[model samples]
Target: MGMGTTTIESAEVKAAVASLREKAPFVYGLTNYVAANLSANVLLALGAGPAIGSAPGWTGAFPAGAGAVWINGAALMSSVTPEALDEAAATAHRAGTPWVLDPVAIGAGAAEYDAILGALLKHKPSIIRGNASEIAALAGGAGGSGVDSTLDSSEVIDIIKGLATRLDAVVAVSGEVDYLCDSAGRATAVRGGDARMPQVTGTGCSLGALSAAFCAVVDPFTAAAAAHAAFAAAGERAGRRASGTGSFAVAFVDELSDL
Candidate 1:
């Protein structure tokens, strides 16, 4: 893939933010227990409604009606079953609802986890967001240690583009300089977040939820770029105001609300 490079302008991101607030789309999230609170808070702070549940009955009904959906790979480690996720993804696909996939720790975990993620791909997610290691592993490289990425986003530009094309989805790799690629091979780089972002748990998972919110109102490429831009800007602001990791986490949500 001959990837064309681009940057997401502040105006485009602002428009996405404004539209998201106005629409306040309901987002269904199938995230793990560890990240659920932060994920829901992030969505709410962004002015999007968030509904999270693992019950098979609820999963069966919610995705079809929600404006967008988010599926985190870690959810499978808990109460969420692969069958339930498949039902949700299938329902969202049938309803024409855009969804985001966060393939967390994909290559670093048991083969069963990887198998679950692989099956989710068949439903055609609108956007796939993860750290470099997760994305690289999904693209057939050695994954990182757990959720921490050993490879940087810059190291896997071509791989990211290829994955985007193969999945027919916008793929966003989170890192110091976030990278985004659409199915058409259009690539974008968003750079601005604070280094302390990784110190806070659930930041990446929350980002996947935010991406789903943006996807409800914009094209997948634009939506993915906008979400990254939003996080970059907010994280920078929160980092400046925070005293520690805990404070930074609180300030991050506040900054997102202000955005």
Candidate 2:
């Protein structure tokens, strides 16, 4: 929290949104599955526009003129071919657009998977959001399952810290306690969320988009804080109202509106 920690005020959040709107309100999403739709909607709800597309072809141009870019590899490997990802990432990189990376199922082995990892390194994402396992794997700690983080947040602090420095980007790891780190070797842990959040499929993806939305408005650190705050508040609000994963989904959307 050292770098501009106290600067995350309401005015800052508002200014970020204003910048986003002026910049095109368009957040190009390079991802897979309905989660991509969910993430795009999340951005729209937060006063930004969303465009869900793959990491290739015309989708590559989508980020060239957007406020921010959010990438989630959840269903990517299954849907968008590796060639598509390569093209899209190149477009984003050349444009100098701030992009977020959600490395779903990272550390899983396959030629395409490895290729995606290499692409991420080349893209030099501004922000990388993943759960503990995914962050750990990205940082050379351990592999993770399909977006399901297997390690405790505290256990991966070192890896997160190291990765943030090495990548020169912000690294966010979600868990019981969420940690956000930057190249400065500083980190902040945010708490307060319903345990039921994990039961929902697209919560993490939604959070990633939210982060990009904030990034569109503010610096990386505060963007992370706003995202963390919004998600935690929404989760807590939805917890009491949700009876199960199904109900939680509805409640979570409602909570997003409330936030």
In order, the Cα lDDT scores of the candidates are 0.89, 0.74
lDDT of 2 by residue, 156-178 (tens): 87787788888889988889888
> What is candidate 1's lDDT per residue for 81-156, written digit by digit as tens?
9988889998999899999999999999688889889888999999999999999999888878899999988998
Clashes by residue pair, model 2: 16-217
The backbone clash count of each candidate, in order, is: 0, 1
Positional deviation of residue 108's Cα in model 2 after best superposition, in angstroms: 2.9
**Which runs in model 1 stand beyond 4 Å of their true positions?**
1-9
Provide the clash count, candidate 1. 0
| TM-score, cand. 1 | 0.96
Candidate 2 lDDT at 104 equals 80
Per-model TM-score on C-alpha atoms: 0.96, 0.88
Pairs that collide, model 1: none
